[model samples]
Target: MPSSTQVQLVRRPRGWPTEEDFRTVSVELGDLAPGQVRVRNEFLSVDPYMRGRMNDGPSYAPPYALGETMTGAAVGRVEESTSDELPVGALVLHGLGWRDVTQADASAFRRVEEIPGGPSSLHLGLFGMPGLTAYAGLTAVAGLREGERVFVSGAAGAVGTAAGQIARLLGARTVIGSAGSAEKVALLTSRYGYDVALNYKEAPIREQLRAAAPEGIDVFFDNVGGDHLEAALDVLNPNGRAAVCGSISAYNDSAPKPGPDNLSRIVTRTLTLRGFLVGQHPDLADEYREAVTRWFAAGELAYDETVVDGVENAVTAFLSMLRGGNTGKMVVRV
Candidate 1:
């Protein structure tokens, strides 16, 4: 028998989650069943959507059960296996994260393909859920067109970074982005493909957005809601489309948060606003993977990860991501 340490949610967070809300527990793993596999996680993902899961209400995904181990995406190597599908030393991707070790039915894991020079941890970032979200939101939800001027809010985060680049690849004439910090604003242009970057903390977003895309924007990829949504609505060109992804701005609010005050513009400008969940659009998964694979191979795309070492620090890494402390994808190295 072996033991593994896992982070369990002991309390449902009210506003912001704290370390006290979680408890680390060591559990003994009895012998595996005939179809079971054991894995040692190499990396685990911490995402903005997890905040919604902390609540006690229903959403696309069920809330994290109190006193149960938290789950997310993880990449790891199978150490022991009783099934032919997964052998010892094979790399895999699974949804049993927030733990250093996992033992489950072999069917619960999927083998990760070798990417030649690319890091395997990317299975938790660029080539995984975040990347798929960006592609589906932009192309399918927003109906982004060629030569369109685009705006992306929260453009320094994982999905934002990918959305900006994907928009450029899809023939966006100009891509503008907004971030909370100066460093992230700089990275939007230097690293990501954004043509113009605005520091939302330094200026009124409406004023900055107007100046950045003076001609008006054709598409908006919204990650931050609240004022960002209102600002985009104010400046969107007639017939503009917006893909409403995550509203990270109000994720931590304990009470009901106000929405964009300028939503009337949607009717006046004949704008199209659509909210989406990646799970709802699995039809685009193969297309997204193929396009992103080509982009990565040709050096047309790049990704970043702000990694926190150790599974004990997963909670801190998650909190840091919520506060915009990470420039790109935030992951915990286990």
Candidate 2:
């Protein structure tokens, strides 16, 4: 029997998750049964939505069971296999994250095609769920149009980076981004294809947004809510659309935060503000993968990964990502 080390949730967090809330345990694995595969994870994703699962509340996904291994998205290689469909050495993407090794029904793992000159971990970032979220949110939810001006909050993070670049690729006249630090702001414009970038910490977001998109924005891809949402509401053009992909700003709040006071603008401007979970839009997956892969191959789309080595550091990476420590997708290399 092989032993695997896994991170388990020991406590539901009150606000920010602490190291004490998680525990690492080594467990012995039983012999693989028919239709089962064991994988050695190469990369594991740490995302903002995972924070919602850590709390004992109703969410789009079920809460993490206490004292069980935490699960997210992971890319790995099949180390042992008892199924013809999943042979040894096959690279696979699955939802068995936060662990160095995992064994499950072969049906739970999907084989990933290798991208030429690209790391397989891209499946967890650019060519995977986050990328799909960006595509669907912009095309379906926000109804982005050519020559439109767009704004994105949390613009240096995974989905934000993709959303901004996709907007430009789709013919947006101006793409504006907001980040927490000067470095991220620079990366937004210089690397992520944003026409304008603002450090939200430097000034009032409403003022910065107005200055960046002086003509008013046609689309707003909101990753951080609260003040960012309020600022977008103030500057959105009439009939502007907002794709509310996340509310990471309030993810760690212990108490209920006030709703955006400027929400009245939605009624007056006839704006469309809609929240979405990527899981609800799986119908767009094929189209998203094709477009993003084509853009990546053509050198028109770029992505970044902030990797923390080792499963022992997965919790640390997750907490750091929640605090805006990562410029792009934050992942753990196991």
All candidates' TM-scores? 0.98, 0.99
What tens digits encode model 2's per-residue C-alpha lDDT throughout 1-334? 7989999999999988899999999989999999999999999999999999999888879999999999999999999999999999999999999999999999999999998768888999999999999999999999899999999999999999999999999999999999999899889989999989999999999888977777999999999999999999999999999999999999989999989898789999999999998988989999888898789999998889999999999999999999999988999999
Task: Please identify model 2 stretches exceeding 4 Å from their true place.
Answer: none
lDDT, each prediction: 0.93, 0.93
Model 2 lDDT, residue 192, Cα: 92
TM-score of 2: 0.99
For model 2, what is the C-alpha lDDT against the true structure? 0.93
Error of 1 at 320 (Å): 0.3
Task: Give candidate 1's TM-score.
Answer: 0.98
Q: Per-residue lDDT tens digits of candidate 1, residues 1-334?
A: 8988899999999999999999999989988899999999999999999999999998999999999999999999999999889999999999999999999999999998977667788888889999999999999999999999999999999999999999999999999999999899989999999999999999899889988888999999999998899899999999999999989989999888777788899999999999999999989988988998999999999889998999999999999999999978899999
Model 1 residue 21 lDDT score? 92
Instruction: Work out candidate 1's RMSD over C-alphas.
Output: 0.9
Write down the worst ten-residue block by lDDT for model 2.
206-215
RMSD of each: 0.9, 0.8
